[model samples]
Target chain A: MTPFSHRKADTVAALGEERLISAIRRWLGDVSPPAPLGIGDDCAILPASKKAQAITVDPVIYRRHFDDSIPPCAVGAKLLKRNLSDLAAMGAKPRAAVVALTLDPRTRLDWLEKFYRGLAACARTYNLAIVGGDVAQADKILAASLTLIGEASGSRMLTRAGARSGDWIYVTGPLGGSLLGKHHRFTPRLSEGAWLAAHPEVRAMMDLSDGLAKDLHALTPSNAEPALDPALIPISPAARKLARDSKRTPLAHALGDGEDFELLFAVRKNSNRASFEKTWLRHFRQPLYCIGNFVSIGKRPAGSIDLNAHRGYEHLR
Target chain B: MTPFSHRKADTVAALGEERLISAIRRWLGDVSPPAPLGIGDDCAILPASKKAQAITVDPVIYRRHFDDSIPPCAVGAKLLKRNLSDLAAMGAKPRAAVVALTLDPRTRLDWLEKFYRGLAACARTYNLAIVGGDVAQADKILAASLTLIGEASGSRMLTRAGARSGDWIYVTGPLGGSLLGKHHRFTPRLSEGAWLAAHPEVRAMMDLSDGLAKDLHALTPSNAEPALDPALIPISPAARKLARDSKRTPLAHALGDGEDFELLFAVRKNSNRASFEKTWLRHFRQPLYCIGNFVSIGKRPAGSIDLNAHRGYEHLR
Candidate 1:
């Protein structure tokens, strides 16, 4: 038989809905505690929680998000991790997730099986339960949307709106040039975020998906603008390497190249930064940098970078 | 200007991401109690609950679920209602929701605004909060995925695994020919399902999406088979009308046509049928039909219709 015919026999269309679902369940393994109901039911039941819950939905689509160059396992892990990054930004612990997938009928069953395996591995590592999901056929393009539910670490959940003027802005690590494999494999700063949230001095926080030049706007109050010290901004090595071939500067890539997936937060300016950095180093190995502060608009420090000059990636542009 | 130029000026690409997001937020209106966070945040926070929570995710894609013939408002409402049906199946009350949308750059901004308005209306009617959302650009098709979270009606939550050998099968309303408008306009049997769940006689329940001919297998036990009565099947007038233009019989359409969005449940064999029906009639104006009962696998009722011959809609087929 030809390769096309052989692959056709292994396609999702040949497997049908029931069998495909069965395979997906097998690939996902088993549902654990905190989730009394899963997969087979119309809805998954989550155990009651006393902590406030945080929920976010994010989807990854073929061509738009990734292409065939990336492994299916990485694609699945990235789908869950992107949502995990959102919860981390809110200082929440992963709990349960439901995935909705739209796939082409010609998709190979093995590809999907591998994808679920990757997702299950990520869930296992994070102590999350893959509770339920829905699957449907698409004419073309495969997309997976993941809804992650998390419980706040404490009564205080971090948000992007509480930053005050003069708050010192910090990022968990280096940024930019995520397209060089880091976009698919980087770790979410969950513990760092939760620890920062528990700290009284940290006022507002968000994860960086879009570049700092764009995402910083979310933390800036109406009366203030973010003033960054270019020398202090930790530029990724990959970004510098990519800058060699492109017309843009390394600073431009650090400012405009999106998909950084790092934790960005503002701390009270009056707080002792030296003491806080010491405490953070003791608890975590990740590099932490205090790059800037929020200042009154039109009063930015001399020699500070102009944010509007470097725009980050925007969808549907 | 040409019609194409005028339309292009109003496309999402022209509106840009920030303006489009602002319009969506405006269309959604406001966030209320239980959900302290919405639209602008990385994650939406929901107040803690004492009761177990039900969660489900469902999506509607351009050619797969609908076409241009259906108004954008109905399409948006149907997306939420489809997920509502899943929550209703478990006897849960709607609480918070997060939506993730993927749109083509060429899609008109007005179409999206109206879609969000319809979603907002549905959310208001159901007392649900439209929490966080993510938007991404797609190459061609437009798709929306909604994740709905709900609390169980009481300590008890109905599932599809509780059916017994002698349980009686019933549906909340007529079935079939949902394409005639009911698919987009059908009322999710939320209150009726909650009532059924509260009743001690009710054993198992689910919303009928993939017609009884196939979905009945979910409630069938290993040792028992569902024996449905043809005479008692409540085929809709729409099914009869559609049958005239199609090759299938009205009964076949009733058996196999999907998207009914009606509740199907099993009641105890020994429950007082007269008293139960009386209570149902007193509370709901909708018709409740006792279609049949679960019987021994090899011992179906004499002259019972053959279920094997009629197949329901299945994705990726």
Candidate 2:
């Protein structure tokens, strides 16, 4: 088989920038709530009175996180977005972030501008400002990492824990090989996370950067299993292309191909009835779906997907 | 005459750790901060209010930052220490830090532990916590970067722009090389920075990761000349060792060598007199030397010790 599966995973050139960003911006357009301390500046500006804070860090490698074929601006923007997405996973608001950039001379200044453009594009859109960071030229590869410092607001700050049996499991945005094209351009669901945290129904929340199966397992409480409906997943065209071969590799891609940057949340069945309302629909331009539900305290989901979870690559495994 | 300077710059290994950390801890130890969100945990936990917040990010590379022969653990600790020192530079109390580690598998975990041990050693003594970070495997050389997050208490924050002509230029700990042998293990002056921030006299501030010459050039405001006394610059054993061979080369090491992690600040004359107090018998572990004074606007000091003004080995140059 050809190493690259164009059918299963598409890119920005294919998705159309308007469609991709429109789909994303619709869900996360507002600014963070005013806080005395936050990750938005050089040092957190949060008020002196809050009890606790939330912080998360993420490192973006060149080929591992994204390909250099993409512009530098996108790389810069997405690096921050990746970390911001982690804070969103914890149901925390974006405060401020620190960036460490290891630059490669192979990347021209124009590329760096584009990189910052992508970064500024995200930060400006979300009202998150670039504060302070280190910059240097590298002989090897270009790398950027962001560490987001945030505050929990009043939400106890959700985590992989706090999920319940029978809770409806859902995902924000479409899924599949975001890597095909979306890897360098995916928008973090920080705004959606803030909204969800404000609502108090986002029992367990996380960002699915590492694919559905592995991420779901991470979110699943240690003692219980997660029951999912393969048919209900919000598969993107990328994943659909993967499955076209009928070898089941595509199905695994949908469940395993990582770096999607989508938010996966578990909600109590009784309280989630209003999730499909007009008010809620405003939070996302892409269709949202209930892929599965949590099961009783029992065995974990034994295997991944039907296409042979083992057939493909497994990182942690 | 080598293409590059035969002299090594003032680096961490040369400064010796005991002298460095002791000076810093004594200054800022009054602040005992805690972070379940530690400097190593993932991210720093700072205060949060009901508003938007801020944080800063910086990255450092190894050959570009220090010589490659240095131990891996020291490399690890230095990465985090540099970031923490940035927080101190801002006069912001450190909350925590997040790291991004990228290197080949050739990078030993044992070295990584020593790095963490150095980081932990510095973090504990500095009262800063390790929060969280990211790690990656790469093919080329090693790269470790950190995004340190700190809180500004309120709106009282320090910036480089705050420096003015006639502000007594001050530095925490000695100038010159600390990286010769112990560069990796040297601590950033996080504590002294916080204390100086609390004090009214200290004005603009920054850490001396880069040598005094290059860093001072950055600190010299308004195009004024930096006239310095070569005799005033504090010389370390590493610097002395480097100087012993070729007076010009190692002096360049003391001048251009980066990764000292010492605090460089501009304080008003007489407002904080104790900062410069040093007797012949008493060793000011982290001493602020009056190497040079800020000249009037428009004049560059002809004799100022130019750490970077002198040509040296290019880390990333």
Candidate 3:
């Protein structure tokens, strides 16, 4: 049979991009499209406004980054949050996002409605716009990736490599249990990141995605660095459950489970953590922790993920 | 089985996004990252340079975009082209791109190598850099979506809606036959677009993606005021084969076979097509045509996609 003949979207229900494209054409009418072509072309190109810089992209997987029952809407919200989080991580203001969805054919419209509702609500929450996106019918499960466009003056941007060895390491919020608690609802910490970038004392920064241990390993000085304490990890209620159920240490999950969207950063050593917290901690509705400090190279394994002596998420391993 | 487990990526032996992410992490160690968080985060957040601005997104499907026989390298190139075309359409100079990959569990490392190789080649071709992307594993066919970032200065970006009545219509290279030719290789006419945008006399513009009929139909002013000559349609060599083989008219194939990545635009009635061709046409090896002109709409079926008269690729009926 010709490839096109067996091209039923249901077989690939959640994976084939063509099947999703077909479905989308029916749902999205001819968008008089402020840009050029809207849905059918290879790319969606829009005019960038002088008032706004433009975009960003955020990708996600089911088991690795989020839970399955996170509610499609919340899942949708999470995807946008993560994307906006990246812009936030860069200290950029939100503008718009386009989603590329890969899903199992079984994905009902109700699920999608909730998903968009959740995602759009978040977009509205941030005042960002959803201009366009595509959907794919997958074979068995659902997956999605979002590309967002945000605007920021060049000087306001920051990077993770900017931290000096003498800088102090600080986190925007408590960094564990993201996968266990309400990860779907976590704010991108955009304001917090932009705020920190505006503050000269904020040297280097990164969002805590793959747990404190591995992420901390990321922040260690590139030239050389001291090791961190495995015992000092702050445990979260969700992390404690991971430990209890899996029979592993809470520190392991705290350092591993991932999906923690908090910002892990370095600031000058003399900065008043309390004073900063007093002004911004209320915005997060959660607590930020100072688990360790940035130190110069010492006599230890460059730095250990310490996995609390447990394993972190490794695909091929 | 659990939701995540029920949809394990490696089910088809495609190896899924898990294995893919692992491979990429090892391949792309921290380069001079342009963003706050590089590959490891939910998204790669590039700190925007105030001097530059533009974001474009292109979603690629499996059967609709590429075939299994397509070399992995070509697949990579196709993904990049999709987004690059968007930037070209906007008359934006290409800069950076973020990829969102979703593939069946059966995908392999060998496949990824070739894919990345081709994508790398495109990056070199366009001087566009790969800033960041996300990978996910699914059950069914494979697909990818890349969001390209771009920038333009002093020039006002071009859009599809700028064409005016009595304006002369023109196309860049050849028209039709995308199925057999290097329709996949046709780069967006960004350089020409930039030149046209600089010339105020160059009215509305847009790239030909959804075939001449639909795309041109889209270019017509709202309320539909235009008359098209069926005989004016341009046919490419590849389109000749598709028509001859399919027992259809060459004009129909050119009108339906989308993916002829040529620029279809309108310029002032007095504009010199000869000079524009001399400066730009020499670079192309294909035939460019002036298919038709805009007219005041009489009752003649306000210009539109004659789906019944011509056809192109369709995902589902």
Candidate 4:
């Protein structure tokens, strides 16, 4: 724990909103290809881009998204990474983001400063401008909502609805048990997503956010359902470790654990699978796994498990 | 007071997040020129635009922004209007927005639906697209954060840094005691702002949110301070009503009460004030007032009051 965390007098309420905002601004520093107008103004002015923009908003709330065990920096990084994953899913290059934070007045100023530092580091790494934001006082909870705007890589952008029957479903890396640490620490599969989007053979694509079991349904068309091979699912070591102390098996955790933040996409069935895998391996260090295929609704593979029997994390449940 | 507000089984927890999101999407309906990809997608795709974009984010929390007396619809409207006011300050045209809402599980579904209805109504009124959004469960408080992307009216957009000494400061409408319904119901000065930006004489502009006393400082350059004519301050009827039972005078309330979401701008020193007023009157039904001028520090006009003595509402104070 930081020294100031234990000091009651060093809270945000004691320092005041204006001072806190100034500290946050200082922590964010500057952005490359600086915005026409940035923080301190009513709005940040973004220059016109030739490519279509992809916009998304996601929030991390205390307890729901993180707990006291998580460092302030991880919490901040998680917020940006989660939104970045959304952009990755759309095969977009992150351009700018605006964040709104609601904090309990008693939150330590040190924690807030560290959070901004982590957020700034992530923004710099991604070359995304921290454009404009607002801070509000909340009664007890702390929450941060980030809206990321990115530029599409090409004319066509990927969505969850484009998967066709017989398309081979793929995941960029291992899945499940993200709660151990990977949930906030994992890197977003941005380059892989962009590469996949550029490939003509790649069909529908989305980031694995709420786990394969739940998210796969999104990529499955109304006339089809996802059929997964139990042996092919890339269950993570974390999922296996978690299964040892839980009632569920490793495969169950791999199928149902959310926050994997990996790229889940579909490629045309007619594409040369071996050649595509070779190209993907050349471009990315992350392992690629062809876990399943989208099949006509009532036609099930001989030994494939029933996806409808599994469930993933659901908010407000 | 809605039919479902008092029903115990009608809460968001009972209804679930997915159903509530579908209801919100239905409430928002469709945009005029439909987006290439919208809600339900990982990210909403916004077609390329020639005009520069202005981005901003602001959030409204349960008690900080509204109270039990304020209807859910008003609460939702207030969230969007606040962000709209920021765009108005920058003289930008509304384009698209993504909202992230954190709601207490026990919040009534009816209230949430009404809130979205109000938000959708406001978005439609401005022809702004509700592109995408996310929902999370909060421990207790209900909060909504909105990130609005708007198109700059022209090549150059207004900012608080453009004010010069001797520039006259003007306000678009009455100020203070916005708590009496005007805070949420007041129209954003969008058209007026665009008009001012198009005019060659408007030097700087910003929306008055934290009251005239505090907000004017944003428009005052480093070399100058704001000089106000007490009689010229447009004290609202609500200010006078609140003043009757308070220690502060109506003028004090006008200067420091805050949440007066009116446009405050600086006009060039040599601009023909009479001609400008006539043009403004011909364009808008809302009255405009020339409050004062920005003057070099310590060179206050004989009758002008010292702005340093007044204070406005500050969050987390």
Candidate 5:
């Protein structure tokens, strides 16, 4: 028998990416004093002496994240923007980034130069420096990964674990149908995220990458779950158009399509969501939709509000 | 014509990884305040408020860095160790790491569990936490990237550009034949690097990844270069054995075979090399060898001391 033959036949493909991530999360148990957040958040929060720093690493691969139809520049920009979106979820100001790219030998120098140009354009807007990175050769696929560092303001870093039972959840911008290629072009809500992070009432936060149905489950405490109102989910115009063309429910798409890249956060129930949304709209052009409230675990809502029971896109399978 | 076909056909595989890296270094420009070292070094040096934080990201892909003969655990360990070796080169103490993995769907669950176990074993020795990471699916290759964060103890973090003309060059342990599979098991020189960092005499430092012949050029200033006493190079027992089997010179393998992962550093001319070596032996069991000295640009040493003129392992070629 082969060396690995003793193990079970179950593979990551069988267990799925979500289960694999959860397994990893369980393996890396708790953080010490200097680290605030660990495996389950958008970014790993660390105590950098005087200030808190949120750091995250994200990777995009050819054929998996994007295809030949997408420009190389967009690929580069998306690599940086994904990490920036993580920082925004933590309510941190994007500071610097280090990128690592493994390219197929056939990748052109012109393509690479344009990729860096696109990455620089996105990084410059937030004063985020492209500090350093590595370039190596791969067999067939081209993959890019970025490690982003951000500093927390107001002496605290927002996390997905702090939402209370009565906290109201809101998602910045509409969700769903991001698979239509906007996933590569969507701007990270840096200013809006930074503004929300400094505010005292924003309880818990995270970016919506895995759709509302799955990601809302991440925002509330483990012992609790979100009770979302079906009608309130702000379906994106793109999502609506796709829904009309495909004869699918836009609400279902909004909750399960994934890759929305919008901030999904919670505020205290008494903090006046309407007022905050008004101020948010004035400060930013994006719309904010109040989608749900946290409820005790095993407690089902009485009316039409749906429990976040649907799973989003599971990558490995 | 294809969308990417309009540009010149100079591809990464044609120009080579080293030239591409050089072009990228030039494109990144200089590091600003709060970032001590950038682009060219193994780790990007950043100021974490009062302390210096050395950050690095490295990626290893299957069919490129490793194959099925190696265990999955070693793959995980090496991914983290490569980044840790970068931190060691910076004379920084490993604090934490974030990992990102892109796996082929066929990758077994047991392989992943063992992989994390190996990573955790290495991380535990240095009190480094496995903070966070992202997981995605790839079509064929399995790629893993690690982002390591280390805190610099001394006020000034080390870089590859501090060597003076008369400085003595030294390497920790022997080099070469790492491709025979020792590359997966080579331990990072973390303790020794941290100790060297605390002392004021060590001039410049970097880890040897792409062989001594090529990496030495990175140590010297732009106008200067290294003049090596080729006979003095410390060849590893493994390299010697491999040399005998292959009917090749061990010296050539030592100078050209990459992935040594040993710390190659410089000491000021005034410092006593014998005394420092004795001290290094006492603190760490590894041997340190003084192999060369820096010289003025265009100046040739007495007999044939190959002036770092030969290119080493240019990936993608």
Candidate 6:
């Protein structure tokens, strides 16, 4: 038999996930795009005739991100929602998406149909079309990757770069312990993002998928450091319940447990915070919390803050 | 172990590829996007303020699409090239792309770097950017899903729907036997597609990915049937060689083998064929062949053409 006959035995576990990602970034980092976009942001902004378009791609894999117990429709919905959240972070209005499904040969056709229907149901709410995509076969695990395209004026688009030292950091909802199930069903803050994009006070924005501790680094400028108050962190009900059953603090889960899929944004400190809060309450029934403020890195203990930031959810143990 | 723990064992082969794709189209088919685009085309056209943006996504899996013998860079290049071919089919100028990679945990970091470097080299030639993408871990196979975005005016874009009974069928280059290796290195006919799109005589267009026999159905309108001349089929040197070694005829390989990544398009029979041919010769040194014409389904023996059209590469046996 040829090498391909048993190629399924070869796996990617050897090099580890983080290293593989870094290698990819290093390889593609030099090709300067038409737009000034890079690999690290939630979405890459493209140059357009009228408004900048934001594009992002993400894949959800079987066993790793989900399992058989989760309905196939929920799987489809989560993948789409994750990409939508990326666009939301950039304050772009998602217009369309393409999904590529690479499935293990044993997947059921009925399950696949349910998945697409679920994705369609979610997309209908936003009026985003599922335009085109490709299908292929994988050997063992099934995976689906969604690429979302959205548009926004350049000035209105948000990124992790513009936050100043005195900017106040806020979150659209409570965070932590999303793995309990909320991670698959949570709605993306599209409307809130659209409103924030138009507001002059919003400085920097990103989705809190990898937990506040890790994603915070993406939003903070090199000259500044995030000074989040542990006591001020609003823990989710799931996190609170999980904390009650375990020795880990709810704050730890709030700070480190990833997959919250909420909006973490910074606002200009001098902006009308009170009015903004009132307006936010009037617009969304969801609770918003002021978590912390950005501070100059030189003013804080370097090693301590660095250690705290490095305490990402992945390394909770 | 939980169901999630053993989920990697589940495969998609049981459902088959075509059925899975059908399920996807059924579920997402109802979304009335802001644009008039739908799912069955090579690329989904999005309405932009000044132009239409074409988007497509494709995934290349280890072993299935390629093996370790093909260099990592070639693997990366092939994945991007495939997506580029889809854009080319629409006569769109590819502007940017987002790549999502799900790697088998054992994949080498160096190999991943080589793949990206390869993709960057190809992107540089077209002035396309590797804007953004995501990375995740898979249990077995290393797969890369690329979402490419391109632009063209609405009138300039091409689709498979415009072929009329009198339109002549043409292919930019010879086809077939890509499994011998051309599938990994063939360049997409972007320039040829662009030229055809600009020509007022071209009636319909699409790329030949899944053998000319199967893809022809996608290009032929419901009111018409394709009547291809087997003798006129331009067999690639690779296909000719494979046919000589095997029992199959070169024409069979040309019609049934896939992944040519060449443009298969239609031109109006009454158009200036001579001038268009001359212009094509001037722009491209590659050979162009006119092998067939569309006929009304009632004008031909239904069973005779059905057998020929059903000679899809996947069921070549």
What C-alpha lDDT values do all the predictions have?
A: 0.87, 0.59, 0.62, 0.86, 0.70, 0.70
Give candidate 4 misplaced runs (Cα > 4 Å).
A1-8, A32-36, B1-8, B31-36
Candidate 2 off by > 4 Å: A1-52, A152-156, A272-279, A282-287, A297-313, B1-62, B66-68, B152-157, B247-254, B270-288, B297-315
Instruction: Return the top candidate by lDDT.
Output: 1
Off by over 4 Å in 6: A1-49, A153-155, A301-310, A315-317, B1-49, B153-155, B298-310, B315-317
**Clashes in each model (backbone N, CA, C under 3 Å)?**
0, 90, 26, 0, 0, 20
Best by DockQ: 4
lDDT of 4 by residue, B59-137 (tens): 8887788878888888888889999999999889899888898887778887887888889888889988888889998
Write one digit per residue (lDDT tens) for candidate 6, span A1-317. 01111222232232232333343333222331221132321122233556556777778888777787788788878998988887788777777676677765445544655676677778777777665555576566678898888876335677666889889999999988898988897998888887787888998788888788877877787888887766678899999889998788888788888888888999998998999999888889986799888888767533333436335654101
Colliding residue pairs in candidate 5: none
Can you rank all candidates by DockQ, best first? 4, 1, 2, 3, 5, 6
Ordered list by TM-score, greatest first: 4, 1, 5, 6, 3, 2
* Model 2 agreement with the true structure over A1-317: per-residue lDDT tens digits: 11122242232223332243332233222332221232222243444445467777677776766674766566667788877887777667665554566655444444444665666668766566444455566665767776665667455666666777777888987788676787766777777777776766667787887678766765676655677767677778877776776566555677777788888888876784564435577866665677777776543355423322423223311
Task: Give the deviation of candidate 1 from the true structure as CA RMSD.
Answer: 2.5
Over all chains combined, what TM-score does candidate 4 have?
Answer: 0.97
The candidate with the higher lDDT, 1 or 4, is: 1
Candidate 1, B6-30: lDDT as tens digits: 3678788898899888888888886
- What docking tier does model 5 reach? incorrect
> Which residue runs does candidate 5 get wrong by more than 4 Å?
A1-49, A297-303, A307-309, B1-49, B308-310
| Cα-based lDDT at residue A168, candidate 2 | 81
Candidate 5 residue-wise lDDT, A1-317, digit = tens: 01111122322223333343344233222211111123321112233455646678788887887777778678778888888888777777776676777866555544555566677777767676655556677767678888887776456567676788888888888889998877998988777777887877898788888777766766777777777878888888788878888777887788888888999888987896678878887888767778878878768477635644455775544
The DockQ figures for the candidates are: 0.82, 0.30, 0.26, 0.83, 0.16, 0.16
Q: Candidate 3 docking: what grade?
A: acceptable
TM per model? Answer: 0.97, 0.76, 0.80, 0.97, 0.82, 0.82
